[model samples]
Target: MELAKIHRLDISKYNLTFLPRKEEMFAEMLEKVDADDAVLEALKSVFPLPERNTDVLLHGDYWPGNILWSDGKIVSIIDWEDAWIGDPLADLANGRLEILFQLGKDAMIYFTEQYKSVMTKVDYSNLPYWDLWAALRLSKFTEWELDENILKTMKERINWFISQAID
Candidate 1:
């Protein structure tokens, strides 16, 4: 429904004036994102320490549509795009938002708890960063469109993300 909502909004007229230049963003990430140090430490502080036997699973585009449901339960998953070895919890953030969209915010807590019971791979506390990152990425993908409403919301969301990072 997020895509549907985006499609309904006129995305052809909007302009995100404060978006960082693509090269600048990439350069900053390259300089600051130390996968072995920064990300690992962040993950450790935010999630349960990985068990010795834990295995990394590639979850490409792990979200709701890829999650199949049967009789009100998720019975399967789909989609293989962008699937690679890393953190599956990264996808949980997106899944959380999707659940909130489909089942409402009130259901999110319970849904999240259930996910934790099953995945048991990461904590939910720091997932917001990943979720916001995904949302910002999505917004950037459509940032050049002409939709005023879409652009405004995208700008607001992206700016909000920048503020969070800065603070």
Candidate 2:
């Protein structure tokens, strides 16, 4: 839904390195994934996003948990702590990854398709960039430790996004 239009804030403030601790955590994960300096540098290149006029009110954390369902239908969405005015792709990317991690790859595809049907202006080309950013943001979680399977999935997802960005 269209929300109040706000002034554009410097996107660098939302990058993985915005916080020292998050940057450290992301760097550690990159090492575990055997990511080279090039990959690290590429991830840092998400700033100065391609000029666009697609800003919207983003849920910011649009994972399944925040979506309330009634009788198998979404009735409402909760959680607004991360809500902000930013590229809509960020929310799409975050939701896609969450669906893939919580549901499955097939579910993610279906969810994406369903989303595309309603939101016609989605810029597919930049999605991978946002996906990589979302993965890096997820890597900052420390209080809630992820299991080996989840961690592996996250790494694979990150790699896939990186590959998409490269190509």
- Report the Cα lDDT for residue 63, model 1: 52
How would you encode candidate 2's per-residue C-alpha lDDT over 126-149 as one tens digit per residue?
777677767666655433678877
Query: Using lDDT as the measure, which candidate wins?
Result: 2
Worst 10 contiguous positions by lDDT, candidate 1:
1-10
- The 0-to-1 C-alpha lDDT of every candidate, in the order given, reads 0.46, 0.63
Candidate 1 per-residue lDDT over residues 55-90, each given as its tens digit: 233343555667687798766667755443334444
lDDT of 2: 0.63
RMSD of each: 13.5, 7.3
TM-score of each: 0.46, 0.68
Per-residue error at 107 for model 2, in Å? Answer: 1.4
Query: For each predicted model, how many residue pairs clash, with residues at least 3 apart or on different chains?
Result: 9, 0
RMSD of 1: 13.5
